[model samples]
Target: MRQEFTIWLTGLPSSGKSTLARLVEAKIRDRGFPVMVLDGDEVRTWLTLGLGFSRADREENIRRIAHLAMFQNRSGVATITAAISPYQRARDEARRAIGRFVEVHVSCPIEVCEQRDVKGLYKKARRGEIQGFTGVSDPYEAPLAPEVVVRTDRESKEECVARIMERVEELGYLPRGQVRCEVIVPADLVDELGTNGSSLLAVLASREARLGRAGGPVTAEEWEKIEQRLRALGYLR
Candidate 1:
């Protein structure tokens, strides 16, 4: 990473924010950059230990994370924060504080996120066990015009990370030469490619990545092919 920047991953719980942050951190680390991840769960455990889920507390949590990210960014260190950061104003405040901030909105339907709720957070939220839960009891303000928007429900983690890194370079956060990620395509997917992989890959990396989500614009046949390719590439199970 030639330039210092903060890649802020924001999304509803289980929408893949924390996972993407770690993956991006590893990629930047591979490029010999000093990168650190401030995961929401981890930060809550220590950094903002006493914080609650109240709006004021959440904004304070974001401010504290932003404070650390800002200083790290200034010291040539990259910071990747995987926080729900559900409030728009707080996120905007963080952006103003961190000059090189790159906001990546990881969006997935609540249904999909609930399906991926290994921690059972969504279930608890739905049951009224967790108060002020985002995407259920509490409101989540989606980002407007983030540097990148990822649909994790459709894209595999590898694809999501690649897309994010690509956008990072495109936004002048990371140098062009540092954007490439060595994604290994599976034999099954490679065979399925049969010369059409490049086009499908283009679709995966395209600005239209959001098109194939459930009830999105893609035709059934097109969506099936995309899914097959993604499965072959080990991006889908």
Candidate 2:
């Protein structure tokens, strides 16, 4: 996550790629390095707005992100990309494009990813609201030889970010011994009824526990936002 590094995040949708990328970016920023996360969803709004969900368009989208990463690397900036990027050919194109391409495969089983439907994408895909969805309608080809692989099922976001930072350091992308941390909370809003003051943390805790029971992916940004709201409401010290 330092200079001249390109971390190509490849995984199925909802496999914790963007979440982990944010964590990694935070850690890198804390170290005073310039970093940017090119998330697929946000990138779609700008770069791939003209592209569809078909195989050809998806490949083109990946190509465009890869090109952007390469350009960033040339300018001595680190690029961390979070994209489904399920096709091996597209990933290969990225590796060829970037100078320091570190492919970090974010591995999560389809069933588990479906269960962690924090974005409601799985439900939409199931209901045929979204077509050519990876792992539902289209295929998700795993990386043949990833530079690093993080299994989302067996790891927390902090741990995954640490692994990626370690890999980037190993590839001489970042300085040695960069530590990473993440704080996640289920972003689903829950009515606290009459809860106030110190009770807000408890309420959020209970809600998060229920979300865990319901199989949701808690995110750090959501937790930070909730903490800010709670502080503004005089809920915590």
Residue clash pairs of candidate 1: none
Candidate 2 wrong stretches, greater than 4 Å: 1-3, 177-237
State each model's C-alpha RMSD to the native.
17.3, 13.9
Q: What is the TM-score of candidate 1?
A: 0.73
Candidate 1's residue-wise lDDT over 1-237, tens digit each? 367889999998999998898899998888766777878886564345445789988997787778767755654567899999999999999999988889999999999999889989888888999999999999999998898999998999999999999988887777755444333334544554454544323322221333322223445555556456556655444
| TM-score per candidate, chains pooled | 0.73, 0.72
lDDT tens digits, residue span 1-237, model 2: 344778889999889898999898888878767677889997665344445787887887787677767655554557899999989998998898886789999999888998887878888988999999899889999999999999999998878888888888887777765445332223332234343435433353334322321123335544555456555656454
Candidate 1, residue 140: Cα displacement in angstroms equals 0.5
**10 residues in a row with least lDDT, candidate 2:** 206-215
lDDT of each: 0.76, 0.73
